[model samples]
Target: MRSLPVYVASVEAEGDRDETLRELVTTDDPDLAEKPIVENFTTEALGTGLRSLRYTQTEEDRTIVAGVRYAWRSQEAGCDVVVIAAAPDPRRILGAMDDIDAFVEQITLTVSSG
Candidate 1:
């Protein structure tokens, strides 16, 4: 399968990852699914070595469905992560709101010829 083309922006964040994440989670939408926030934060793993946070957020939710992932790619680690939220899908045109949702999704797949 072919990979989807994603639009990404550079993010360089300074501060505590857990604290920033919590603030982002709350500031962005305090009512978002707790599972995404409470259950999925790997702060311990993301701590210590993290001097500065660098990642990209999804920027496309204009035409696609909701509850879809807005993502960020850890440039140093080569890991792509999603911010658990969906931007409004009313306009197909990209905007600041769209930029808030960085575009990138990573998946594993195997190929076989039959």
Candidate 2:
């Protein structure tokens, strides 16, 4: 069996939540194969969010990479949290969707009372 690379990253940003989420999925790179598949979703920890799946061709080797990004805004915290999962093979990304969903679902943000 062949092994593929998988990547997961998360970031928290303080700014316009909607705009932050939009920026997370937007790319001006010309290497993209086509427009990404974007959709809106609601999560238990976060109220409303966006999920985007995009494919891009590497400039060096021209290999295709599939990246899935999930962005959620914390109204109480006044910030947005974005999570990204990517793999060299699109099938690998698809296979990890469920695990990614569960990981995102378990995220809980805490705000200080001060």
Candidate 3:
């Protein structure tokens, strides 16, 4: 049995990055809409033309989750890459942020330019 919400991180290829991001940020769940977003930011980094965003949102049950998403265009890879991390609890997420950031920094992508 899982007490905490199951938040999964994933990366995939997609056509519309902004549209996908908007879908993620906009809360359709009535439970989550009451409070809305707490804070959010976006930037490009990683030296591979990577774009990323981190946002925290208030859940319907009054709990909160922080999420990070990264996207980049890759020709040889056949599509753009999108990476996501969904954290259900701020305290626990914050405590692990340092380790998380370090781990993310190690991710390397080789996109071939044809």
* Better candidate number, 2 or 3, judged by TM-score: 2
**Whole-model alpha-carbon lDDT for candidate 1:** 0.33
Candidate 2 residue pairs in backbone clash: none
- Local accuracy of candidate 3 as per-residue lDDT tens digits, 26-101: 4333444243342333223333433233444565565566554444444445454445555665565556555545
**Superposed model 1: Cα runs more than 4 Å off:** 1-9, 27-37, 41-84, 87-114
Worst 10 residues of 3 by lDDT: 1-10
Top-down TM-score ranking: 2, 3, 1
RMSD of each: 12.6, 2.8, 6.2
lDDT (0 to 1) per candidate = 0.33, 0.75, 0.46
**Cα error of candidate 1 at position 27, Å:** 6.3
**Total clashing pairs in model 1:** 8
What lDDT tens digits, residue by residue, belong to model 1 across residues 1-114? 222233433345546555554444343443342233232322222322111112223446323322323333343554443344333342322333243332222222123345
